[model samples]
Target: VVYYFQARGHGDYDSDFSDEESGEKSVQKTKSVKEDDLLRKPFQKAKQGSVVHRRFAAEEWDREEARKRRFHLISMDAYQRHKKFVNDYILYYGGKMEDFRRSGENDKTDLDVIRENHRFLWNEDDEADMNWYKRLAKKYYDKLFKEYCIADLSRYKENKFGFRWRHEKEVISGKGQFSCGNKHCDEKEGLKSWEVNFGYVEHGEKKNALVKLRVCPECSYKLNFHHR
Candidate 1:
């Protein structure tokens, strides 16, 4: 016996049962016009410009969250290190770090100092100061990216977006006392290092970037070591 079920006024189909030659009852189901309409409701509500707006909003939110987290991780010791680096860079440019610091008494946190420098570089229209500010900004971001992004494999993988390392000829780029990239590694001493190239897609363009990282000789066999 076969049963044909008609959908109610809502336009959704109901389940039906059929008796087969094997003496077992078989069930069938179908979606109704109402169900199809409901499924398409979200797409219908999305207007032409809404997708781009939503994407921009999401990107802004991600950047804001990252900025907040980065600032939060800046401890007094880290901040001091950053300050010293900035001061040294300023001295190289024949400027007193104290002068820069004294330029803004209200800027208390590291974030404030960075923001002030960034603003000064862009809005103040000083060419020399602009170059110095660019160097300072690069160093500041590099240190933080190394500590928080590169060293933590999980975080690196998560925040890497679609960027990936392009394994070409392996070459050591710098000489320095550097710790292992693995956060869980027990090695505290400096080890040999290498700079690796990474590729990513941005704004419909392919771009290449490099990062210097060290790996523990003993821990090189680990899966995450390649990322370092």
Candidate 2:
């Protein structure tokens, strides 16, 4: 077969190249020409233009990036400030409890003192501010205690812990009232009435390890840490 094909091609030089090779060469040449054209076209267009548009686009992109960075910085600053606020508030309440002790209220249970202090911190209009406080507390506490590992509750085991609490403050008269707070059931509805939610704290450990003296429920959820 080799001899036969070699003879057919006449003297081993492929005097008449096969159609396939010819077609392949033609494709290669066309591809090279197209690529060269593509390369040159971009340069030609760029040369025709003053590069002003490209510079403007680059500058705009930089400005947009800078604006995004500024927003991020501001958000981070706000978060840090809020964290300090929560820490200070907790410390203030703890200090207030010291006052109670000095005033001969040392016989009061830790829970009792915490409850009393929380009541003192609250006003009738406190309900309106509860949600905002909740959000701020979650954000800052999560960052300090979870992400930055700044606050080790185990270190301050005996420190007073507080919470923005929502309890079963008596089921609504007649049918129960459900707030739209349930995520799983958006359409869930029931009898409606305002439930009193107040902020409270406890000194020392709670049964739930997550809700123990180390961290509050709101911060636990924010940090995605298991409570108990």
Candidate 3:
């Protein structure tokens, strides 16, 4: 006689199966088997009073594939937004370059023309301007790499604009500032590193940002924009 196995999450048992059409059956329970080992075995017994819940492993794999597809879709949306910011920033720099090129032409050599062009490019913003993207990128990029083993955002070739677009968003939105972090100095250019160094040094002692980001008492002395 063919035997049917009952499925239970935590219970274990044993049994046999014959061709379903013939309806012939096996007479013996071959051996005691644990739940994990018995999965592929044919003609198994279910735990007493348990029901068989059949599952095809392919359904699980399909669910995982769907999740991956959704993730890529979200990433593509972010990429498009980043691309738009890059185009806008490029236009802004191009205008500045045009002005500089015209002004330098009379007294400038071929070398000066090239240098001025490069200067404009260097002075341009590093990020696309979209609110909250900078904050998200700041936390997301490192987390994604460490936990998921994903490549850096730099590897997203389709988003050639780079994560710097997030910095531009922060600056434009006023949620943060882009100026040098030093309080005494008026320099508008420097990495965000300087801001934390001058303003958040005491806060940095803690490895966690919550502790490191405590408000700087000295920052109140400077203009709010300078704190950015």
Candidate 4:
């Protein structure tokens, strides 16, 4: 059953998911998730419309833009043979072959690019904190290999760019082009990720924006509940 989770503030601990279809089916639960200083400390400084939030958001906008512009799609063959967690593509900043810092094969994956090249890639943070970031980055990337990067065989090869599973021989145009438009997902290819128009908002003076997103599959399932 598809459900929507209501975010409860930290430390209070009550979290719940309400079934979209039944409306009466609501499950209340507590999450054991531990938050770090970002949630407790930095978050205070990063308040909406504050100087801190604006500063990081602007820098993040630029860095994310650069990552997409520099993306180099690795062949499917490389992804399959990967001993570690696989990625959609790699990043190259200089836009040239020799700029790769790795020795021998000069091979570096998106997995390591951020940590190794943080000074260049991450512009928002102060330079003095980069060393701490480097250590943190290492642990995070190692965890990435274990956690979020797992290749789900069920969801595998569904063609992340709005394509059907390979088994379907015939398919209609504009059919399976999006996963979900409800919540945000992090596949790391941010600039042109699969975006399906969710809805529209009317602005008094400015043009209306058609909301679009690439969200997790569970959220995607909610879209079909009403149709059934």
Q: Which candidate is the best by TM-score?
A: 1
- 10 residues in a row with least lDDT, candidate 2: 144-153
Q: Which residue runs of candidate 4 sit more than 4 Å off their true CA positions?
A: 1-194, 204-212
Q: What is the C-alpha local distance difference test score of each model? A: 0.48, 0.41, 0.35, 0.36
Q: Candidates' TM-scores?
A: 0.25, 0.17, 0.13, 0.14
What RMSD does model 3 have?
A: 29.3
What value of lDDT does candidate 2 attain over all alpha carbons? 0.41
Candidate 3 deviant stretches above 4 angstroms: 1-30, 33-65, 74-228
Write the residue-wise lDDT of candidate 3 on 22-96 in tens digits: 343232223323445667556765455854344655777789999997786677777686665566777876544
Candidate 1, residues 89-113: lDDT per residue as tens digits? Answer: 8868787656665555554665654
The best candidate in terms of lDDT: 1
Ranking by lDDT: 1, 2, 4, 3
- The per-candidate count of clashes, in order, stands at 0, 2, 11, 0
Q: What is the lDDT of candidate 3?
A: 0.35
Off-target runs (Cα >4 Å) in candidate 2 are: 1-33, 37-48, 53-228
lDDT of 4 by residue, 4-49 (tens): 7666645445434423433443221112224334257643653456
Q: Which ten residues in a row are the worst by lDDT in model 1?
A: 166-175
TM-score-based ranking, best first?
1, 2, 4, 3
